[model samples]
Target: MPSQVEVMVKALSRLLGWIYTFCWSASFYPQPIYNLRRRSTKGLAIDFAAINVLGFICYMLYAASFLYSPLIRKQYAARNPISPDPTVRFNDLAFAVHAVILSIIVYSQFWPQIWGFRVSRYQHVSWPVAGLFWGCLLAILILTVVVVTQSPDGGSDPAYWAWIDVLYGLSYEKVLITIVKYCPQAWVNYKRKSTVGWSISQILLDLAGGVLSLAQLIIDASFQDDWSGVTGNPLKFLLGNVTILFDLVFVVQHYILYKSSGDGEDDNKAPDPRTPLLPEEQALQR
Candidate 1:
């Protein structure tokens, strides 16, 4: 029989899991919303989305791998036999699916507009090229998975240690992806001196989700007396803080740093009737 304290902790953990799930799933919607509202992908960077898709693929694989890993499952069963398995859950799967779908949507926005800018050296890369880049990345990921699964010793063979190493490496790659994910967008905002097409609300929601997710982990680790849940996945811990950091940088850029520049001019001055609407604006007007 479980102790009263264990029961309470389990219930709290479940509740926190649901909250984290919702926040994580909802975080993917903001950029798509901004794209729809603006009807343009002008300032958004394609590489960021491309790299993000790859990172999400790795994350999905990592989560799924945990579900099948005998060692991981056994560990969970031993630790909390009465409670649900924590390795992979509906919310975790949903987060993975949401990420892939969102990445595809963001990638799709690069077309047609990219074609229009083909003559410019700055916009030389096309959607197809981006697709090719993603294809290469996908191939590499598939190859890695194949190698991991085919290990002769399987999970038990010391040779199988390579598989664990790969998983850890992939997790670290997610951290790297998170670190660089916002760079291109930030650069775009800087060069254009505006964040008009970006959604600040989305950033706020993302930050909120990240902070809550971290809190949930802290709670679980605290009550369980097993810091391995954290140390085992350092990237997840780092990801939350890193996300909040970048979001703050964006907030400052949008509100203070670029307040007097870019679209700020348009906000302050009367419209010049002679100035033609941007392609996206024209599309919306029509």
Candidate 2:
């Protein structure tokens, strides 16, 4: 029988897991809402959305691996037969799947706005090209996972090296994806000297989710002594922290540093009578 403390910990872990799942899932929507309201994706990076989709896909795979990996499932069953499922709840899977869908919606918003910006050269790469590149990379990763996990030697043992290969490879891919996912948008914001089109609400929600996720990890580590929950998947440990850091940076940029910036705001401002207006501005004034 589990101790009272252990039971309490398990309950707390489940509660935190659901909360974190909801927060993380909901966080993906604010940016899309911001884009739709503004009818612009200026200051937002398409690459960020692309990479976000890939990252979420990798995370989903990692989560699903817990369900399918016999080694992991067996360990969980041995440890706690009553609730032996190692997989995250279906709700968590829904959250991850929704995030990916939201990312695609956000990615779709980029092109329409980019078309409106009459610049000599587009700042970001072509969307289709970027999409293809990421698609190919994801395909390669899937193939590698299938090949390794299907090996005869790998199937012979739950603790086979190939199992570790799949687990760690997906985990590391998630880490890499998370590390680079925010860079494009951050760079754009830096170059533009503002985070105008980006939603502050999105950052706030993401920060909330990240903090909660980290707390969930702490709860697991404290109650279960599941260091492997983190060490085995350092990305899972680091993702929330890194996201919080970047979200804070974005908050500072949007609210503190660019508080007085006229870049995004100027889009709605009336044309100055004293200054000659561009053709587009003249049409808008009429």
Candidate 3:
């Protein structure tokens, strides 16, 4: 158990964590939106999209299983006090829907690149089906998910199956994918000693959010007497805040190198793929 002053500091830590996280969420759009409008993914890393797909799939599982989760039911009842019935918990189905939608769109993000091992990419699939399928799925998924997660017990640990689903399903293949697909690209970029262009703001925010999350962990440790990640929910307890520090540091390293070295763009830039590859760029598939 932490002392009085420690508790206060922990509150501040949570506040900071949430602030940065929300900022990160807000930041998600601008870069992608900009990329779409500009029709260029110049500075964007494919790993980001891949990880997001994994996260959404995890969210889907996280949201769908809440109704059956006894731990969640208990927590929700405790928080609400008024609505203790199981029927009140029926609204917990939205998360699964969102997860599916997010997964679909996440695939769409890379669809152009991967859509065609066959024909030209633009001719691969009907745009309408792809778009509408994801849009509807996301809408239904989000509504139900929000109803549950925000209902006082939203952040409760996942059910056992949900835990397993997320752990195995959302294994970020970004780093591995990067190694396989982009390693050669990275080597070429390194030879030129620059990123053909990776989005600066996105990576920067990813780093910041990771740091803020770590700070939140430290604060939680400072205030909580038990300080055990070992609750009924072992995954959240054991590995919930995992990899955040490394993520932050990794992003910082990239940002600093890019900042100091100046843009890798040349005076006569003629759309050479090798032009923007960074000397240090490699293995971000995770």
* Models, CA RMSD each: 6.5, 5.5, 11.5
**Candidate 2 lDDT by residue in tens digits, 1-286:** 8999888887877787788778887778777766666666666776777677777776777777665667766654554444444434454566677777887777666665543432224536656537655764775578566756677664334444345455556667676777777777777888777677666777787888888778777776655455555554465577788888888988888778876554443344565687676556689999
lDDT per residue for candidate 1 within 1-286, as digits (tens), equals: 9999989977777776678768777777876666655555556666676677877877776666556777655544454444424434445556777777888777666665542221113533446535644654675577567656876655344334445545556667677777876887788788877776666667777778788768777777677576666665565677778888998998899889886544421233455797777566799999
How high is the lDDT of residue 30 in model 1?
A: 70
Assess candidate 2 and give its TM-score to the true structure: 0.76
Please tell me which model should have the higher TM-score, number 1 or number 2: 2
Instruction: State how far residue 232 of model 3 sits from its true place (Å).
Output: 7.5
| Candidate 3 lDDT tens digits, 1-286 | 8788877885686576566546455445544444454445444344444434544454445434445767655653453344342221122234235434544553465555643212223322244434533554564456556545555545353331223222222222222222232233233334444443444454456456546645555455434443331232222222224334434433444455444444432212444675554334544532
Off by over 4 Å in 3: 1-10, 42-48, 59-68, 72-107, 112-192, 230-286
Clash pairs detected, candidate 2: none
Question: Against the true structure, candidate 2 has what lDDT?
Answer: 0.67
**Sort order, lDDT high to low:** 2, 1, 3
Off by over 4 Å in 1: 71-90, 113-155, 158-162, 260-286
Which predicted model would earn the best lDDT?
Answer: 2
C-alpha TM-scores of all predictions = 0.74, 0.76, 0.47
Ranked by TM-score, top first: 2, 1, 3
